[model samples]
Target: MANKTYSFYPGCSSQNKASSSNYLVSTNSMCQKLGITLNEVPDWNCCGASIGYGGGGELPRIVLSARNLALSEQHNAGQDMVATCAACWLASREAKERLDHSPQMKADANEALKEAGLEYKGQAQARHMVEVLIEDIGYDALKAGVKKPLQGVKFAGYVGCQTNRPFGIAGESFENPLYLDNLVEAMGGEAVKSYDQKVTCCGGALAFSEPEKSQKQIKDIIESAYDHGADMIVTPCPLCQANVEIYQGEVNKRYGTKFNIPVTYYSQLITVAYGGTAAEAGLNGHVVAPAKLAEIAGK
Candidate 1:
C-alpha cells in the first residue's frame, strides 16, 4: 500500500453530476485503502461549465481552476492535482499550461489568486486520477487490493468526449484511449463494447440548447448498446449520465420501446463488484435501477 497523499479537485460535476459523485466517492474509498487521501481544494467554482470559453474569455477557466490549483500549491506546491471530471480536468490542465508557459497569463492569474490569499506559481501538475492509478499505482497492485472480483460481469466503458479529445493537449489519446477499459479490467471485469456511438455525446446541455438533437443522440447510444448486447454502460461524465438517465423515460415514451440500460459511473460499478457497498459508491441514487447490475452480480 502506498502512503503518499495527493490532492483532488472534485469539480462542479462531482456534486451536480450524479455519476461524478459516484466516481469520486468510490475513488476516494479506494484511495483511502491505498494510503492516498483525496482532499478537496477550497472554494473551487465550476470549470466554466462548458459555456465559459465560447465568448473568448479565459478568465473563467483561469480563475476557477486556479483557485483550486493555488490551494494545492500552498500545501504541495510542485505536486500534481487530480481531477475526476473530464471538463474540470481540461479546465485545470489548460489553466496550468497557460500559467506555466504564458508569463502574462500567470501574472493575471496570480493577481486574481491574491484575492483569495492564494498564489499561482505555475508548479502544480493537473492529472486525471485514472492516470495516477494506472501509471503511478501499477495495475497488478490494484488487483491485489480487490476484495471482490467482478469476474463474471460485463461492462461497457464510456469515456465521453472531454476525457479524450482535441488530440495531444487533452493528455490522453482521443483515438486509442483505453484507460477506462483498463481500469474496468483491473477490477476483474471484462470491458465490453457496443457500437461507435459509445464514444458519442450524451446530448449534454443540449436538452436545453438542442433538445431534439440531444434526444436523438441519447436514443442512438441506448439503441446501439441494446443491439450490441451491452449489459450496462459505464461512463465518467455526470452530464452524460443525466442525459441518458433523465431522458430514458422520454426515449421509451417516444419510441414505445422499453430501454432501461443501467448507466453507472465506472467507479460505482468497480466499487460494487469489488465487494464494496453500492451505496458507498452512490449507485442507489442512479435514476436507472441497478437491478440489471445486481442480476449480473448474482450470476
Candidate 2:
C-alpha cells in the first residue's frame, strides 16, 4: 500500500489526558497498516473549545483554528486535517464554517493570524477519525484485515454531541446517522439499538463548566442505557469516555442505579476485533473493563 499522508490534529484533551495515549498510538498503528500516514500539525495550540469562543470571544476561536489549519497547509501533506479530540474537532469545524460563510470574518481572522506567521485560507478540511476510517478506508478493507471478529459481544453505540450536532453544517445527519453503528457491525459486533439519548451529549464540557444540568443529562443518559439493557457503551470521542467513566460512580450514587457499563473507544473495539487483546487496546485502563469482549469476539 502507498503512504497516504494526512495532517493530524491531536487536540488538547489527548495531550493532557495521558490515558488517551493508548487511543492515539492505536490509531496511528491502524493508520500505518491501512497506508494512512498521520502528519501531526506542529506546535499546535488549543482550539479554544469552550473557553476560546465565549470568554475571549469568537476571535480566539478563529485564530486558534486558523493557526492549526495554516500549519497543516504549510506541510502540504494533505488537505484533510484529521482531528482526534471531539472538542477540537467541533471548534475547528465551527471556525472553518463561520470563516468561510463570512468573508469579512475570514479576513479579520487572517489578519490576526499574521502575528503567529500564519493565515487561514479555509483550504484545509476537518474530519473526525471515525469519518476517515469508515468512509475513506471502506468497510470491506477493514473487514479483510480483521484477524478477529466480535461475534457475541453486543455494543451500545454512543455518538456524542459534537460528532453529530449543529445539524447541516457538520455534514452529518444527526437523527439518522449510521457511521458509528456501521463501524461496530464491520467489527462483527451486534450494534444494539438503544434509546434516543444515544446521540446525546456526554455532559463533559457542561459537567466541568456547568455542573447541575450536566450531571442531570449525563445521569439520565447513563441510566437510560442501563435500562435499555446495553452490555456496554462505545463512543468515538475521548471526552465522552472520560466523562462517562469518571462520573458513572457519582451518577449511580445519585440516581440509585447501576451505571456500571464499560465505555470504550471505537478504535479500541476495532483493535480488539482485529485479534488484539485488552492490554494492547488499553481496555484494562477503562473504568469498566469489557472482560467478556474478547471471548465474545472469539479472540
Candidate 3:
C-alpha cells in the first residue's frame, strides 16, 4: 500500500541462505509496516563489493554493477534502486556516477552488457535503504509510527566503511554520522553518542586472511560499544553485522576478555519496535543473541 515501492538489489550476502538472510528478512517485514515495499531485481549478480575494489579493473567492476542497473531499468523501470547491503549501495552508486560523469564510459559499459542483451542508460537511482528511510521518512514520522519504544536498552550506531566513504547519507557527517543514533532516539532508546568506533573498519573479508589482525579490529569495534555502555550495536550494513556478530567470541577468547555484544540490522529493530515479533526481526541469525531487543519489544 506504500506509494514508494523501490526496486531491491539483494546483493551477494542475502542470497542462498547466506549470513545476511536475516537482514533481508527483517527489511521486508519492517518495510511492510512502514508502507514501503521492495521489489527484487531479477537475475541480479554480485555487486563486486571489496573484491571488485581489489581487481584494479575499472570497467569490469562498473560493468558488474551496471548489469544489475541495466536489468532493473529493463524490468523495474522508473524506480529508485534500493539496496540493504552497504557494499551494493556503494558499488551501484559508483557505477552510476562513473557512467554519468563520462558518456564514453557509459557506452563502454553498455557494450560490455551487449552480450547479455542489456544496456544501462543509468535510469534508476542507486540508494542505500537507510538513506531512503531517513530522508524520505523523517524522524518525526518514524517516531510517531513506533508502537513500542525501545526503553532502557543502550545502542551504538555503527556506520562502517562502505556507506561512509566517498558518499555518506545526504546530511550526515562522514567522520561522525548520527542517522543511526537519531533513529535509535526516535525509537526511544538511548543512543551512545560517545561510541568512537563509528567509522572503523570491521576487517571485512580480511578476517580470513589475517585472523589475529582482523580479530583486533573486531575487538575494537565490539569493545567500543560495550565501553560506551551499549547493550548492542545497530548498523545499516550487512557486512558489518556479519563481521562483528560472527567474530566477537573469537576476539574475546584471544584477548582473555568477556564480551557478548549483539550486532543488529536497523530494520530488525524497527520491525520489533513497530509491534512485530522477535521471529519477524530475524534475531535467530545473530551469533550474539539480541535477547535484550526481543525482551524490549515484548513489552
Which model scores highest in lDDT? 3
Runs with alpha carbons beyond 4 Å of true place in candidate 3:
none
TM-score for all models, in order of appearance: 0.88, 0.90, 0.97
- What is the C-alpha lDDT profile of model 3 across 1-299, one tens digit per residue? 33588999988888758989999889888899999978899999998887666764789889999999998999999999999898899999999999999999999998989988998987999998998888888888888988888988899999898888889888778899889999999888889999999999988778878889888888898888988899899998888888888877787789987988888988988898899888788888888889999897666
Model 2 lDDT per residue over 238-293, tens place: 77878877787877777787677888788777777776656666665666777777
Q: Which has the higher lDDT value, candidate number 2 or candidate number 3?
A: 3
- In terms of lDDT, model 3 sits at 0.88
Report the alpha-carbon TM-score of model 2 versus the true structure: 0.90
Ranking by lDDT: 3, 2, 1
Per-candidate RMSD, Å: 2.8, 2.4, 1.3
Better of 1 and 3 by lDDT: 3
Show where candidate 1 strays beyond 4 Å: 16-20, 54-56, 167-172, 295-299
| lDDT score for residue 29 of model 3 | 85
Distance from true position, residue 126, model 3, in Å? 0.2
- The TM-score-based order of candidates, best leading, equals 3, 2, 1
